[model samples]
Target: KISNEITQFTFPFDNDVWSIPVHRDNSYYESTYKKSPMSKTDTINTPATFETKDKLFVAIHEAALTDFASMTLLKAKGNQYKSDLVPWRDGVKVYAQTPFNTPWRTIIVGTKPGDLVTSTLMLNLNEPSKIEDTSWIEPSKYIGIWWGMHLETFTWGQGPKHGATTANTKRYIDFAAEHGLDGVLVEGWNVGWDGDWTADGSSFSFTKPYSDFDLDEITSYAKKKNVRLIGHHETAGAAKHYESQLEEAFKLYNSKGVNAVKTGYVNKYLDKKEWHDGQYGVRHYRKVVETAAKYKIMIDNHEPVKGTGLQRTYPNLMTQEGARGQEYNAWSNDGGNTPEYLNTILFTRMLAGPLDYTPGNFGFDYKLPQGAKVQTTLAAQLALYVVLFSPLQMASDLPENYVGKPEFKFIKEVPCIWADTKPLDSKIGGYNTIARKDWNSENWYLGAITNDEARD
Candidate 1:
């Protein structure tokens, strides 16, 4: 049974004021430390650390628990203290019996934040790769029909200008083949778009295609161009429905020679009950990865659960859009992501796993439908191809937009996977510089970006 006793633990330091990181939803901005109320389900298992000016830091690592685990920072008046942050006092209580092996409570001591960034502690904690035969898994540069839909230039559904029609897809395939890109992503080719899939969740049918899109024709055309067709399954946050269709959907893709799939969970739960990082959502994601691997299909998850070093075990989990991604620039009303955004994520969210940020956008001055603008320069956008590490990278802008642009050459030449990475410089939310050696070729690439000010 779970107990609610106020347990007081003492550390070596005696400072009254302390900084603590409260565990919240992974998508939310959580930087400051405050003594506030929080639910047990919302709490993070990772510990809040204490750092000294001399570059010494101490962090408490909690053991993983199957049941909901929550914590609140408590400051002692003398040698003892009481717990008052109890938002989940009446909520679900987790229970465990004896002989249950709890996760390790590790205390990691590091010289600086960068030391932790370079540490292999998380990787060491995970088991080795389960897939012995990884020859089919190759890093790739891809182009897709996603950006135009986000920009409202075309609709996801059938219309005069549908983005995923057979003709439009062939255009993307031609571009990919000419530019030496490995894959093409065609979204909204299915019959579910006309319904309210985001709210109702029963509107999508994965196996069925729209009347305008001939799957066989597009697949054959893509094959002739020597470009792999990356499958798209936008669940619209309907995990339960997607789960039922996994086997058939994967089989269809496998038969069509489609090797990779980009799965999107863009909305909340259909039942309106659970958060994406909760246990239910976590299990659903794992199920997709495991089932996809059975069909030799790699997965790139969008609006996914936070990466917790699962890629080590499941290699088919290529990359995920777990943070604020490039689509924000196309539709966000807040004037898109700041220059410091990616620099901060380099150490924070990226430390968990590879991210599908979809970096290549040449139109720096292009205004979105929401009146927001991309805040970075053309040079900064080029830098992201090297800075953001994803096995599956996308030349996100349209082919027409890239015409006659010299920077487009870098997108074509930049390697998606790296042999080794060196962080030349990193300051949280300020500036970051990184160098990476290409995995196959001996070429090296460097990417650097500053906050809002120009850096020399």
Candidate 2:
């Protein structure tokens, strides 16, 4: 049951629907009322959103964050949009005792569409902070060898062009020190990235480094340079194997003064059978977060379960990527994300919590290996730093790409975390403008974006 006060605010897909297009993401426009998405048995994934004439309805799962990644499917039926909450979609036998609890199936009612950007309902529903001392949970901007790997200028595995190496990492650390960046992220520094890292991550070692990366020396060098070393733990969706190494692995990074980790689960399923968004995967992800907290380590999760304000409870659970973000524009199967993608999520998935979108790739002129091309303009890349919210923002281009460029200046000046934020104006999947005040300074930054056809 919903609060009586919000009952009038409820306007589902009835005849009140407009001729507007519905978005699953920016690229999703096939299912507008013009041709009814309800014609088929299409089930929308959890933590999704839909736009009405004047309201924003957020279909979220597990509002009170728990150890259950239940899938909440939204659909338009019976002249109104309805939601069906299920425990697991993978057809697994869920064996739970009667005394056990269930996940919270919920929907956030926005008085207006802008509430998706402003309301913290999901975070508010969660418990208070678990970490009493949050002084170490600080936010900052970073650069990495990541983009080059995506562009194929460098490889993840070792060779002449391997992105993660002792010299390459030190240069990135030096760059972070020179600029105002607080940390450097180095992926593929560990072994097991060679040969099909995604198919089977059983060989990945959390405590050991490749012969060329030199973890001890690099971490020590970063410490001397007044920069932190953000660690990378790419599981390739091998959840069980990674789970076995969690305690010892995090303990290793903690000892090295590495306080933050970017964990990846880049597979369709966990352990070749477990759904990454099911109860089994849910327990594993939470275990990683709580385990990292014991070592004073923060987490940035990619290929993640939909965030539900758990960061408010565990401030160390900083950011995650559950949407099809900037990287898709770099290289994906279907060209790249459409121009309207970022603007779309601003009012949809973003309602859940912080997202590590890894923005600011100013490589407009650079040639991609495939016929792939960046779909957005150079200006939007700059605007993303402000429009997209994340405490741990990434300058996700090669170090060389930013050299001596005018747009790079805005990226350098933007703050990752905000003291306050306000959405000035927005049209779902069309355009958006937002202003944010830096948490540590008096300065405020404003950003605006439009769909691909917004301007010439």
Candidate 3:
């Protein structure tokens, strides 16, 4: 049985209405047609949208970073007592018994589109931080050994050009120390990279380092340099296996004084037939976050569940690569990301949470193995540190790229955490200008970006 006329709600709209749909299902696995309200063309039940005398704006929130709920918005036509009329419906179904709460349905009410940019509704909706001891959790700018592997100049698996070897890692640690950076992320340092990780179910051992990479030596060296080592766990989407090894892996990192980790779920777990955004995936990610918190380890997720406002609840959930990040420019066959890409996400995807976009690319004109090139300028790259909100920002290029470069100053100086933010100017898929005040120093930083067009 369906309920009739749950409530008749109306708001004055001048130009268009933007409505964001909330869903708990894994968005990455679901088809666009199923996930989007606009796809429900024939039915009166469209995604949440507002229509005024002018234009109509429909906004859809894609993918669930967390689980089991469904939400929708329906528009009411004229006053006809017909059974066909569908009233606005926004609800959720959870199989779990009592004492559970549904995720917040965020509706930002504002006069203009930019007004939505400035709203604090999402942060306000989330519960206060569950982390009591935050002394260990600090925002940082990091340099990592991961990029060269992506560039294929170095390999994760052994043989030649192995990126995570002890000697190479020390170079990055030295670079971080020289640059006043706080952390160093070393990926592919473990034993299992030699195999087909996706198929080799339980082959990866997180605690054990590869023959060439000495965990003890590197951790001690980083301590001498006053730099923290950010650990990496590439599960290759084998969540169950990763979970089994989680305790031992985190224990290893903690013992080494490595307080942060970057986890990757690059592919789907074949046996489970599950997507990254599905219920099982959601729970798997949550378990990782909660478990990491238990060990005082901060998490930076790559190819992760879409970040809902969970960071507010779990402060250790520092940042995530939930969108098309900077790496696409290096090896993507699609000719890298466009100028408009960042602007598009700033309003849409970024509304959910912080993104580890991995900004700081100085080699703008450099061509990759795939012949893809970064389209943005050096200035625009500098602006990204301010534009994208992530506590764990990265100076992604190799240390050699920053030598004597003026733009590197911005990357070095930008604060990783902000106390206050003001969305100065914004338009969906067009341009964005944001100003954020540093949390510790109270200094202000501003980042502005234009789409494909050149702007003054």
Candidate 4:
């Protein structure tokens, strides 16, 4: 039964409303028709004015009230689920995958009741309201380098030619300091590993050095060069125990001057109750945030909680790898970094919040051509710095690939975080164009990419 309890609003853009409607199933989209309130009388009364859509997590509007006449039919709100509306905006939007005792408020757009519009919707079960914070980690001045396990997996003591080796790692550190990168990230630094690829081997070292690679020396050396060392804690197959040791780990590492840590629980996909953890995969995540905040050390999550836009509450939650990332190079026979895949992410995964899916691969083709493998063209990689939003952005490619490449100038120009983010245009699974402004500068950065055919 369709309930008559209606939520109405006008549009909020200068152009026709280009909105992504949120449904009870947690799905969202870019509506084909402009959405707006309809009167019992269909008369062109006034000039085009703005409207707003106030929902828990989204708010947007349509300024040019052009094709909305056909989209007036809305699904009935019932005890089963509630509907949601969001208007497109050019700024950061917050989402929460699980409930917490933090303050999150909804953004109301448009001036009048009939002027509001909604773009996306979700199942709000004790759902916390979405609110904006005046304080956000501005990413304009910082550049980040991320070195993780998969690449480390390829090194195999064969030197830099294979992948990430000790010599290559040092070169990366030097390159960051020399080329003006503000921070460096090293994942897979935690203990427990088998020599030949045991999934969860017991023979690992947390405090000991790895085959002559000293953690203390790396941290100290990076510090001497004025570069920040980003730490990683890979609790392989151990989520419950990871939290118990948080304080001890933080104290020990912070004493060594490590300011940030990328904690991971990639075991979710593994078939085990211990691996599933609990509640939207955020029960343990909240604990980590609380503990990390107590220590005054920031965090970047990998294979952590799916961003329900919690960065608003816990600013230290930098970025996450919830989707298939660059590591697909090693596993997938044919890398699946397709244009459609990229397009699907914006409408799906990114709607939740910032992703640490590191972009920028200098080479492409590992097996067939035997060269460094990259997913897209260099320009597409460059555009990712603009399109894919994250607070701590990464230049994941090897230093040697970028040593003589002049195109890195563009990569260097991309801002990590922005004061405003505009979903300029989108075709859901086809293509999307986005524009972002530096948090401090007046300049704007735009990134646009297409799916297979490029029709959208």
TM-scores for all candidates? 0.84, 0.89, 0.84, 0.66
Task: Give the backbone clash total of model 2.
Answer: 0
397-427 per-residue lDDT for model 1 (tens digits) = 8889998998799999998998888877766
lDDT minimum window of 10 residues, candidate 4 = 62-71
Estimate every model's Cα lDDT from 0 to 1: 0.72, 0.74, 0.71, 0.50
What is candidate 2's lDDT per residue for 1-456, written digit by digit as tens?
A: 111110111343432221222223321122222212333325555455544444445444347646543544444445344443333444542445566554555666665557667776677778899999999898879998788887778898978899889998999999989887899999999889998888899989998898998999999999999999999999988888998999999999999999999999877777776666566767788889999999999999887766877888789999988777666666776666676666777776676678788888777776665545677778888888888888899998887788888778888888888889888887767888899998889999989899866453
lDDT score, residue 5, model 1? 35
Q: So what's the TM-score on candidate 4?
A: 0.66
Residue pairs of candidate 2 with colliding backbone atoms: none
Ranking by TM-score: 2, 1, 3, 4
* Cα error of candidate 2 at position 373, Å: 2.3
Predicted structure 1, TM vs. truth: 0.84
How many backbone clashes can be found in candidate 3? 2
Best by lDDT: 2
lDDT of 4: 0.50
Model 1 per-residue lDDT at 300: 97
Q: Which residue runs of candidate 3 sit more than 4 Å off their true CA positions?
A: 1-94, 198-201, 269-271
- Residues 3-39, candidate 4: write the lDDT tens digits: 2223333333222222323222111121122223432
Ten-residue region with minimum lDDT total, candidate 2 = 1-10
